[model samples]
Each structure stands twice: as C-alpha cells, then as structure tokens.
Target chain A: MGIRQVANTEAPALTAAVDVRDLWMAYRPDEWVLKGVNLRVPKGQLWVVMGPSGAGKTTLMKVLAGLLPFQRGTVEVMGFRLRGDLTPPSRRVVGYIPQQLGLVRGLTALENVLLGSLARHGGLGPTLGFFPRSEVTRAREYLEMLGLGDKAETRVFQLSGGERQRVAIARTLMQDPKLILADEFVSDLDLPRAARILETIRGLVRERGLTLVMNLHEIQLVQELADHVVVLKDGKIVYHGPAGTLEWSSFRALVEAEDGRTGVAGW
Target chain B: MAEPGSLAGKGRDVNLRRWQGLSGALALLAALGWVLGRMGFFEPGRLTGGLVNFGRFAAELFPPDLSVLPVVLGALIETVEMAFAGTFLGFLLSFPLGVLGTRTLFPRPVVLAVRLVVAVTRTVPSLLWAVIMVIVVGLGPLAGTLALAVYTVGYLAKLYAEILEGVDPEVIEAVRGLGARRHHLVRYVLWPESANTVLSQLLFMLEYNIRSSTVLGLVGAGGIGFYMQVYISTLAYSRLATVLLAVLVVVVVMDVLSAWARRHYLLDT
Candidate 1:
C-alpha cells in the first residue's frame, strides 16, 4: 500500500505522450509476435526502437498506429486508450509513416501530402479531389520545408527513394498529429541523405512539440538523434533507457547476439 | 532388397509413356481429319462453286443504291444513339456493382454473389439479350439500348472489380490510416490509380457497342440492321451494299477516334 501510494504520487512528474503497459499481440491464436512489452515516451521527445530483422519492431509500430489489434494489456496514446477491438485514436492525433512510405504512386507529391489533411476536412469538397486554397498553400509550404517545393507536381513513382521519404514526412507533418510513428522509412537511403531527412524530421518534432517513435537499424543516427532508445529482440525488450546512458559496444553486442544463434542477418 | 535393374526399368517405363502420349496425339489428329472429310472441308469442287457464287453476288452489289443514303444515315444515327445511351447507363450501374464485387472491399459471400450475377449476365450474348429486351419492350431502340446497357454492366463490372482489387494494398493501408472512409478510398486510391485503364476500357466498350448495335435492328430493335433484313427479304443487294459500306465507314471512324482518345487522355505519356 505504501509503494502504490508512492508510485501514484510520482505519476504526474512527467506527462506521457505514449504509455504502453504489458502489451501482448499476435497474428494467430497461441502464436505470439509481441509477448510482453511496456513503453513510455514523454510528451515531446523522439524515441527510437531498434532491433534485428523479425524482432517485432514493425509489429510494435503497427500496434501503436492502431493498425493491429492487441490481445492483452493497455496502450494509451495522447491520453486516449487504444481499444482491444482494433479501434484507433483519431487519425488527426496519430500520424503513421509505413515501411514503404505509403505514398500513392500515381498521385503527385502535392496531392499525396494533401492526403494528410483528409481528417481535417470532412466535407464533400476534398472528397471530389478539391482542397481549400489555404490547405493547398500549407501543403506547398510543407513541400518547400522538405526541399521538395520544385517537385510538387512530380509523381511519387518518379521520385527518388530519399525524395519519397521526404514527401512521406511532409505528409505526416500535414496530419498535424501529436504523435508520429515511422517504420524503417529511411533505412534505404545513403548516409548523407538519411541524415538530411532525419534532421528535417527531428527539427519538426522539436518545433511542434510532437512525440515520435521510429524503427531504425542505424545505431549511429539513433545515437546522434534519439532522446531515448528501446532495443527489442524476439519480441522482448532487452534494453530501454535514455540514449546517452547505453554504451555503443554493449548495444552492438545485444543486437549481434542473435546472428550466431539463428541464421537471420543482423545489423 | 531393391531390384538390381530398377533404374533401367524406370527408364523403359518413361519411354513407354512418351510413346503412348505420341500415339494418342496422332489418333486425335486422325479423328479430326476424318470429321473434316465428312464435313466436306477438303472438297475442291464445293470451294470453287462457292467462290463462283460469291463472285456473281459481288458483281450485283456494285454501284450501291445511292438513293438509300438518307435512310442509311438515319439508321446509323439511331444505332449511335442506342450505343451512347446504353454505354452511359451501363457506366452508371457498373461502377457500384464493380465496387461491390471486389474481394478487397467486401466479404467473401458478398463478392461471390456479385461475381456470380455478373458472370450469369455475361454468359448470355448481347444479341440474345436484345432479343429478350425486344420481346419485353415490344421492339424498338429502347430494347437495343437496354440490351447494350445490360451487356456493358456485366462486362465492365468484372473489369472494374479486377482493377479495384489490383490497387496497391500499401496505398489502401496508408489512406485508411489517415481515417479515410470507403468513398474516399474509391475516389482517391482506386479511381486515380486505375483512371487510365478504366477510361480505356470504357472507350473500348463504347466502340464495341456501336459495332454490335448494327445487328440489333435485325430483330426489329431499331438500328441499321433492320434495313439489312429488309434488303435480304427483298433481294435488294445494291441497297445492302450501301448499308454495309456505311457500317464499315462508321466502324473505321469509331476505331480511329477511340485510339486517339485513349492516346490523348488515358496514357500518361
């Protein structure tokens, strides 16, 4: 009773943007992909989830995005608890950038970015491929912020991998969500390009006071940018702490341990 | 405990199967040849006689009856109208039926039922559909128009279903994550992704309906084919030639226009 009271007393010291408690998820019955996981991100911070292939990184992101239903425990994002019945928070509250970037290949970069503003305009105007002039101007501003102002009319299929990644970030920014979830959205780019894009995303997160949870394999970028880090292996959190506290050698050993046990490749 | 020559035995068995397959194919070919012979397909005298009769008929069809130009033009207009109305009506219904038929959008039972209906409708030829409509609507352009519309619904529904089903799943997931409703998916994802193919298919269907509408009038469904039936009954070969010429000209023009429209509006390049 004394410990419970103490825990309750300290709960208000930090406001949590994402609070996940004892979460369990699976695609099939009795075959768990995420066994037991707990995570917490402060109101305005960038958190990186790192793991080897098939370590439930993508699965965790999907759960947080409300794309997948969980079997056990509670997941609360932006103060609203996610329902076990697969109901998600309002789309305006959570922005998700999928692994493939999820930009419509046939649509222009501007149109794709404008898709982020869909939840804001519930009228028939946007439904018929029409957007308010102000929204269009804002979408252009987002593109310009991402250095894609010149290519706004270019189709997504015509854009390079790095360019496509920037467009996706712009789209997410246009969502005006308090929380952003990205799943390996930049693992394909070169060092310079990835860093440039990461800087843009990190800048926005700081300016807007948005909480970000991204899945990445790059320890260098994670060390440089992430405020907190969570290392997952086989659906379990092996390490969870502030980014500055974890040593690079120990983090590398934890990620590389599974490479010898299973034939799966690791970073 | 295996036989010493089992490998050799397997080789012989394979060779025997190959010989059996070759013999079966030869027997099928011989059967086909015998049927063709019985049907008089190789009779030289029958072929020569047919050619001679065709030549004589062709001789009489020349200098086609120019006096029937006004009649042929009016019938041509009616045929075009029927095709246009039918295509428009079919497009209106096809989009919804197509959406319902897609497995990605609806449940298995719903998709199966919609596909079954579309399949049964498609199984009946457009000409037969026109005949049925003529019986019900008492023989006019309305029957022809309804027939083409029904055929278009069956044809375009299946096409639209396949196109919608083929939309990139990742795009759909992303859009849904944005809190897009079903109508948003249709208008934004499905429609834009498949606009070129859908437009091309619609134009092709229009062209096909125009060509087929010429035959609807034979059943008194009000098109140029009515004049064809009249020409045949009255042995007016010259007038028949004129109608054929008009149909040929219209078909060529429709083909060219369809091609141009597809290139200009549908293709990205």
Candidate 2:
C-alpha cells in the first residue's frame, strides 16, 4: 500500500491535525517550560509559533513531535492521542525537523532522504541500505522539489547551511507525514532563500493538505507566511490569532517587555 | 654595585629566582633517584651483567637453523588458524552482547548486566585464559582457540558498545522520530555510521589475537611458543632462534595485511 493510504487509514476524520489542550511541560521539577499551552491547528494550513529565546517555542515543538514528555497535557497528533508515550503509528505520520537540521554529515543527500522511507519499507531493506527503485525515484523527486536535485550525491557536510536545510526539508518530505513540525526551519537561510523555502513548503502543504506547525524567529517572514500566529511569553500563550490582524509593534513590545523582566533578550 | 631600581638589579633578581627553581628541580630529581635506588633500580652490577647476557643471547640467535623450517611453518600456520577462528567466533558472539550493553539503546539494568559480564571477561588476560582452557580442553590448538575466542569476545563487546554509544545523538534522534524501532535504529543508523570504527577495531583485535595466540603455546596450548619453551628447556638455542624468526615473519605479515584492510575498508568509508 502507498504511504499516504496507510497514513489516511491510521488517521481518522478530524478537522484539526493537532489538538493540544492544557499542555504543561517542565524539563526540571519546579521549573515549567510550557505552561498550559492550548492549541488547535487545523489541517492544510501553515501555523507559525513565534516568541523570544527561552520563551519555550522549541520546547513546544519538541513536545508536539513526541520527543519530549510533558507533565500534564493532552496532545493529539494525526488523530492519535499522545499520552506520554508515542505509539509507532503516530510517529509515522508526524515529521520533525530539529533546529540543527538533523542530517547525517557523512551521508549523501540522497542516502539521507532514502532513510525517510525506512518505516514504509518494513525496516530491514532500508537498514541494509537498499531502497526499492520506486522509493529511490520518489526520493529523487523530493530532492528535486527542494531544489537539491543536482547535489543528491553530495555529502551533507559539504553542503552550505541553506543547502543543508533544503536537504533536511527533502528528507522530511520523503516521509509523507500528514503533519510536519519544523523548529527554526529557515533560520539559516538568506532572505531570498528563506522566502523560496517557505513558499515551497507552503505550496506543498496546500497541495497535499499537510498540517505545518513551525517555530520562526523572523517577524516579517512569520507575518508573510503564517496563516495563524501564536505568540508565547514566559511559558504562556500571549497571543493566538490570525497573523494578518496582529500588529508587529505590539507583538515586539510584548516580547521586549518580557525580555526586560527576565533579563533575556531576543527578537 | 647597582641601584635597586636599575636593570642590573632586575637581572640579579631574575637570576636568583632561576637559581632557586633550578635547585628545587634538582633536589626533586635527587629524591626520586634515591627512591628508585631503594626500589632496586639502575644497579650497575646487575645492569652490566644483564646487558652482557642479552648480547650473548642475541649473538647465539643469529645464524638461525633453517633446517626446522618445515616444523616451524606448520606451527606458525596453526597459530594463525587459531587466531582467525577465535577472532571470527568472538566477533560473532560479541554482536548481541555489544547491542545489549549499549546504554543508549537498552535499559539501564540490561546495559549494566551486559557490561558487568564484559568487564569480568576483560579482567582475565588472554594468556591466563589460555592456562584455564588448557586444563579444560587439554593441550593443543583447541585450547588456544577457545582462550583467544573468549578474550576477543570480552574485548570486542566492550569496544563495540562504546562505538555504538558514541554515534551522533542527533542522527539517532532523527531516525527515532521517524518511527524507527530499536533494531531499525541499530541496523540503519548505528551500524552504518560506526562501520569504519568497528572494522578498524576488528582488524586490531585480529592482529592482537595473532600475537597472543603465538604465546598461548607457552602453556602447552599449542603453537610455536610450545616448541620455543621445549627448546629452551632442552637448551636447543638453534631451534629456538628458528622459531623466533618464524614468529617475527608471521607477525610482520599479519601487520601488513591488517594495515591494508584498514586502509581499504575504513578509509574509503
């Protein structure tokens, strides 16, 4: 069966791809990183989570990706309820892009992308570094989509920062995830490259009806690309509204005020 | 006489500090020398006598008897076979133990248990293991093979566990995030990433086993070392010289082969 068919069968009919309610997380006792975060991300739209450094944006992304365990929360991703432990089925439908890009430096772009189909190929084939011809073609196509067709055989370490990010995106795309969680996805790119990467991701989301939850630092890019914006401050959601309606100056003021109070500064 | 504020006074002060430091170092060295002397080190009589005996032994080893070439070759082959079989067997057995011993992949208890077994095995030297194996399996290559295999398992298992644990956490996390099971994580990410180091370690173990197996015969476990011990007891210096030459050639050959394998396989990766 195709990966999308399997994903569709696993995920029941739900309007919201991600449904997080009363989420509270802490890396240590007595220090809460995310405080009662409630979010409802509808399918097939780009939602950006923006905040200053240490505002728990990356923490929330990790929680959604099932990498971090929360103290108290109900996280539903791709219709599967994540209650501390993430099931294999839920993981198959959620793609995570970490801030470091998460690409193996020694592996070529094509080889890294081929790793995304590991779950679909039943583990053994991919483990042996063998991908079926169809999967190989699809991997190439994903690389091409991310504008890395020419550099498929290039080792990831040899690629520039922006190129490496594109390779990461291609790898994520190859997973055929129903929902994608990207942390600082374009933070390494130049203005034009960032715009291009975001446009490509936005196009793919619209075309494939994939849910995108991204943590972005660029205010202008967030405004330009985000369908909805959720502003976090001091482990709490300060604003959750449409990106177009939110004023940049007010959002910056709220972030700066929190930064001054905590002696932590970031745009 | 120079004024206190003059450059000459400063130079005198520097010289004074240097002299003090030099004297302190000299005193420390003298103390260490006295301690070493107390420990029976660097005795001129024994040192000169030992050097003279060593030179006589070296002179006797020259003009080695090539007449025993056939017997020496056979025993050398036996030693090589023992090392090969032992290393291969140990490598096969170490796989599961190494996987289980990895702290990142398995639970704490499982890792601890596996590591405990590895540590216990590692504590026993290969030659000591050969002595025990000689009692269990009787004399010959069988005992040597068994001893080497056991020792290799202990060493390689710990080495492999360390290599697996040293893999990039980011790569592992990425794979795990993609719904990879434990086996999948090991087979795809861990093994491929650490293949070069693993291969290099394996080659090193094989080389070590070869050198070790040659000595296993010293305990009647079978190899050129058995013949060497017999020759020494019998005062047959010529045959002992021949045996040592054979061992030197075999070790050199093994080293070359191992270096080639490491370069070809590991460097390419």
Best by TM-score: 1
- For this target, which candidate reaches the highest lDDT against the unseen true structure? 1
For all predictions, the C-alpha RMSD in Å is 5.7, 6.9
lDDT of 2 at B265: 66
Error of 2 at B167 (Å): 1.4
Could you tell me how far off, in angstroms, the CA of residue A127 lies in candidate 2 after the best superposition? 4.3
The global C-alpha lDDT for each of the candidates, from Candidate 1 onward, is 0.87, 0.84
The worst-scoring run of ten residues by lDDT in candidate 1 chain A lies at A1-10
Q: Can you tell me which runs of candidate 2 are displaced by over 4 Å?
A: A1-14, A123-133, A150-160, A244-251, A259-267, B1-39, B267-269
Using DockQ as the measure, the top candidate is: 1
- Fnat per model, in the order shown: 0.61, 0.49
Tell me the spans in candidate 1 whose CA falls farther than 4 Å from its real position.
A1-13, A244-252, A256-267, B1-59
Error of 1 at B125 (Å): 1.3
